[model samples]
Target: MSAELTRLAERVADLERRLSATTRTARLAYSSIEDGAIEVYDNDGTLRGSIGVQPDGTVGMVAVNAPPPPAPAPALVDSALAGLDVSWDGQWANDEDTTPLDLALVQVHMTALADEELSEETMVAALVPGGGRTGVATGTYEPMWIILVAVNTSGVAGPPSAPVQGQARRAASDDILNGAITDLQLAEAAVTEAALAAAAVGKTAIQDGAISTPHMVANSIQGDRIAVGTLDGDRITARSITGSQVIAQSLTANELAANSVTALQLAAGIVDATHIKAGSLTAGLLAADAINGKVITGSRLQTAATGRRVVVDPERAEVSIYSGIAEEMQPGGLHADVLDLGASKQAGVSLSAPSLGKGTAYLAMQSPNTTGGAGSIRLEPSDRITEPGYTYLLARQGNSTTQELIESYASAPSGGKITVQQQTSAGFTWRTGTTSATLRDGVLSVPNIAVGTARVTPVADKPTSFRVAKRLEGKEVRAFVTASTTVPGTVVEVAATDADNTGFTLWVTRTNATATNVWWLMIGSDA
Candidate 1:
């Protein structure tokens, strides 16, 4: 079996060698070729079939048969829709000569079955050219519902017309007689003014009261045109006589009845001052609140009497009593002799000034004689004997306008703490003799000597020193020293040293070692 297998393997090798030689020398033809294209031809070399990229770059195959021709463009039909009439030949018979330029085609959609209910899915569409007509294919006399849609060249369709019924037939103008179209047959406003000849409508043509105001042009009727007594109150419409219709100054008092020209009859702002007679309008003629918010100018209230005219200036919100005529009053503000506010317990006056400034309330007293007494502002309690606490009068100091002297009375009994204070940075002064004594910063200074007492302890038989509280300007300080306890034979001495404007120093001398407590009296010139 091994030998037989070897023989078979040798035969296979021999067959492969023969096939390799044949493949090298012989050519193999393929029934179909792939790279982009393949063409089949007869012996005449005419192309019969091909599978290749077409001229449009799409891969396709073609046989001897050609593709079907594309569908023809839809035909156009001219017909009138429902509620519209067309000629017998199905042409639009409208008076207009122009047609839509963009109307390229019309699609005629009709119900498919004779009695079938019409819907979009059940209807069959037949396209036609715009304004062209075609006959229906129905044999029976039954009506077929149809709808027409206008299509442009871009295949865009406009809204469909109303569905039409029955065949496409309409009565022509030639079929109707001359007077057959009556008013009932014509649509509303069919015959306009332009359709009638000039002066064609005479008095007999219009019925009585048929020609209303709207039928006549504005201001067309004149007095001369109307017969006398032809137009009376019943003939004229209410408010029909406008301002332009009435001649200027023609309507006098006799022309209108009394109280006839009321507010309702007159236009707003038409009755100006020129139309109104002076002094003709009385208080009874005006409404109660007619002048509630109205402005009255000062010129309207001028008077000849002096000190009797009161001028109220609305702009300044001020009322001034004038002592003379209107021309004598000041132009800007109130110029009056006096402004007297009548006695009222609740009414109090207030005056304000700018910041960092003082407001002054002046009182000028008329003295009977130059010697003494004058009218003064007396401040007293309303119900009690004493005035209220902190109730004081403020007055500017002599020759200094900014400095004020205040004398405040306490709220206590008669002997209470009444104090006098002054608003000054330079302190207060008390003038008695030829010189004045100034008290500043809790320190009392005098032109003469100031005396005070102090206690000091001195070292035994040693000279000791201490400071004095009183600030003295002069160095002339005289001091006396004595032992605080009763010492029989103790000698002590006190002397002032280092005297300056602020303070002074006092020195003490004691002879006995047992004596320490020393009392001293200092007298110094403070000024």
Candidate 2:
């Protein structure tokens, strides 16, 4: 029984050894299903072995001994660049720190590699599981990297990694020079004037008929490119050029085709008096209502010269004075200047015609005549009589320089006693017998008077006693009476008094005398 138990114990011990070995292998093969990674750990839970498909889709494995004691922070040795992302590997792992460092120093240096020279350095967070397979940093385009360094939790610094060199992709112009592109390869119309070098694509460079309208870009041709007179009438389509397309004031009369410029072709209000040739427009050339008020400034037709007749209507024609019709006619013809009085007469003296007729006319001045009717100045013919030595009835002085005699009148100074009409070389002249009077403003003034005694002859027969009466329209009148002869024992008196606005009464008395002779005088106005 003892021997059988010993054998049993030995077999049990052997199985136990086998189980221990299998357990060791199983621990090495233990994997994370998500990442297909096999990991081996020591009894102290430290990483010892790892086998996995890496992030790059490549198989990799690592075997490590029990880690050495915490050493200085590891260093980066080499780096590779893919676009902006940088990858690096180095002796960065240490047993003293979990991962690279719970608080690690990961620094990246960025620099513009070409075209521009710029550099900046910054600290970045350490990537997970940082060490050999670490994502370093992302940098600007065309960037050239600097060495990467790290510090562990112990504040120990690592050596710098090798710099990663990079360059930007080639530009299109560079591509063309490298035989990567050809003329046929360019998109249609891709080449532009701005893109060409100075003096490039000259006439010699272009093949004949190679650059037609389809090949040329719109609005690319300049005025200097076109030769003078190259574009004839047939070359241009009608109305093809708009007003905006033509430079202002660029066209002259010679440049336009014959009969090509019409009203429709012209911009509104572009043609003014300055553009029109004198006498080019006439009444016969005008269409009915072709010219509107806005187009024609009526003032342009106004002639400043006076005395020009303007036919304003079918019924009448008027004399124009500085673009306006004359308002009145004086002895010197129509007046150019007029003053408005606002419903009142404003002239020093104004004369108006009675009515419109051949005989009807206005005179600025009239000369009074004692023998006949008044004579006046005429404006239609602008006529005046010139009597060099003879006295004229009326005279008008203008501007102290010129004087005109309106008329010559025949005057009979005394009361009318019809005499034989005779023509004398001195013309008609009369003298009053011992009496002279001056008339002004319908009033008569007698400076001196004389009385003569003659048989007291009465011009008209009267009953017993009669006094001569005179009519006066005024407030009052003064009379002066003188006896022709003063005889002894005889008295005479004369008095004058106001009557009803039309006349005055004169009383003549004589006592102890059968007859008396008297000369009477009166002064008053005729209203």
Candidates' TM-scores?
0.22, 0.24
Please give the clash total of every predicted structure, in order. Answer: 9, 0
lDDT of 1 at 388: 46
Per-residue alpha-carbon lDDT of candidate 1 for residues 325-410, written as tens digits (9 for 90 to 100): 34442322231222222211121122211111212222222211222211122232222334444233323233211223333333
Cα lDDT listed for each candidate: 0.49, 0.44
Candidate 2 lDDT trough over 10 residues, lowest sum: 414-423
Model 2 segments more than 4 A misplaced: 1-177, 184-190, 194-199, 202-232, 240-527
Residues 1-527, candidate 2: write the lDDT tens digits: 99999999999999999999887786637655444446566786444555785434667765544332232233332433423344444333353444442325455544434222222223333432244334443322344544455544434545444454543332345334677668979997798778999987788988887876666665678888999999888987777566656788898788989998787887765687988999998999987876665444333243333554332221212232222335434311232222333222222223333232223233454332322222344332212233222222343322111222233343243222221111232232222443334444444444332222112322223322333344443444555555565574444454545533333344445564355555656555443
Q: What TM-score does structure 2 among the candidates reach?
A: 0.24
Show the colliding residue pairs in model 2. none
Per-residue lDDT value at 413 in model 1: 44
User: Model 2, residue 164: displacement in angstroms?
Assistant: 8.0
